[model samples]
Target: MAQINLQNVNKSFGPGVPLAVNDLTLTIEDGEFLVLLGPSGCGKTTTLRMIAGLERQTTGDIRIGERVVNDLRPGDRDIAFVFQFYALYPHLSVRDNIAFPLKAQNLPTEEVNRRVMDVAERLRITHILKSNPGRLPGGEQQRVALGRAMVRQPQAFLMDEPLTNLDASLRADMRVELKHLQHTLGTTMVYVTHDQIEAMSMSHRIAVMDRGVLQQVDTPLNIYRHPQTLFVATFIGSPPMNIVHGRMVGARFVAGDGQFWVELPPAARQYTQHDKRVSFGIRAEDITVGAPGGAGMAGNVVVREPLGDETVYVVSVAGKTLTAKTPPRIRFNPGENVSVKLDPAAIHLFDGDSGRALLPEGWSKHV
Candidate 1:
């Protein structure tokens, strides 16, 4: 296992095109599963390629273990890259595909055969060893691709959305298998993916990127609960955090439309003294919906989404739409009147203009 480090790394296509990665400095510890997460065209893939020596950084240094391998060829990097498409040879059998890398190095036939069979058994693909890539299921094909990478026994593994092509159920299953595989092998892994679930579920630490810039690097819980920026607050959640643009009026945050307000607790008083125009954010699950006559902000339900175990209700309040995730049994029809209660402790406050969280010092310390 090896620790990978990138220091002051920047990549650009040319003058007109924007830099793909911008002054990004991060470290992937030995035997760590670090995930690079972001939307499309966010330079995640570029960063991974740079680490693999597939794409050279325009400026700055990349260090694998103790060596500054900025000029090393990809073949000499001692890292294996598993592509999203599996990239297995169509004509070669699963055994042959997994053994191809060993064969190229001209290892003894017995050694290569033993290694291939071992990986196949570990991946539970030994039954399909004689099958071609074309005949295997998406999950099996992905396993074969992983097997090929495993047989190399490289210092680290870099994957670029390797599970993106599988069906939803299959992808879910493979995620478990992949995480277990990584734990068993104890190899340093740097994974790139846009799927929040994948990043949240599999990573030891998540690096959230946007427009080639690193947003926040933290555990899944920290990223979700204490997002450093408005972009991250809205990006990491499933239904996304519901944000209301408002101005502070004494201890209450009044919505922009002047139709509704949420009372701020004493803990939030310090943030409103100078910054009146603030953004109030709350997760869908943090808002409670009550019966029409109950004591809370009144709103009209606009949509009801019944997820298996939970239900999401979108309500229009103060000219803004806010979503509330509630128990599945708590049914409310569209146009029905309801009361909404925001959890003061769970509330997130941010600056309207700068879009940065205005966390209280005590709260910040806890986070």
Candidate 2:
């Protein structure tokens, strides 16, 4: 296992077209599981391709371990790439497909058979070694593809949305299996995906991107609790954070048109004096909904969605709609007047003009 580094990377298709990746400098530590996460057209796949030597960068230095692999071919990079779709041969049996890479290197027959059987047993596919991949189920076919990559024992593994073809339940199951596999093998992995849940659940650190630019890189909890930008605040969450357009008035944030207001925490007050126009952000779970005429802002429930264990409520407060997540036991109906309380300690503040977070001094260094 080796650490991968990219310095001042830039990828552009042509003179008139926009760049696919821009000045991306990142390092993937040895034996680390790093995920490149973003929406479509965000250059995550391009970055992965560059690292695997499948696509060359217009200007940059890419080093895999101690070697500068800018001129090397994909096969010489000593890394295995698992494609999104299962790329298995129909004519070949599962055993032969997993052994194909070893055979290509002209290894001894006994060594090849031993390695294939070991990987098959580890993946629990030994029973299907004689079956054709074309007839197997989607999950089984994926395992075969993974087996093919694992048998190589390369320096690292680069995967590009490897589980996108599976159903929701299967995808969930595979996520757990893949994380366990990575931990057991202790190899460096660079995964590319647009799904936030996959990134959140599997990665040691997530590199969030947008329009070919890196947004933030942090652990799952830090990324969720303290997003560095507005884009991250809205993108990483399942229900998304509730955003209210407002301005800072003294130590309090007053909604536009002067309909609603909330006090800022002591730490946030230091930065509020300079930036008058700010956007107030709070997570769905941070807002409390109760009966009307309480010690909080007054609002009316606009819609209610029951989601088994929990319910999500759409509330209209001061002519602005905000979402609140609550337990299913706490029931409320549409058009019902309710008291909404915002947790000041859990609130996030962002500069309205720049869309950057307004955080305390040196707050980002800890994470």
Candidate 1 lDDT tens digits, 96-208: 99999999889999999999999999999999999989888888899999999999999999999999999999989988988999999999999999999999999999999
Q: lDDT per residue, candidate 2, 180-280, as tens digits?
A: 99999999999999999999999999999888888888998889998888888999997999999889888888996778888776666777774389998
Q: Judge candidate 1 against the unseen true structure and give its global Cα lDDT, from 0 to 1.
A: 0.91
Q: Which candidate has the highest TM-score of all?
A: 2
Q: RMSD, each candidate, Å? A: 2.0, 2.2
Off by over 4 Å in 1: 360-367
lDDT for predicted candidate 2 compared with the true structure: 0.91
Error of 1 at 231 (Å): 1.2
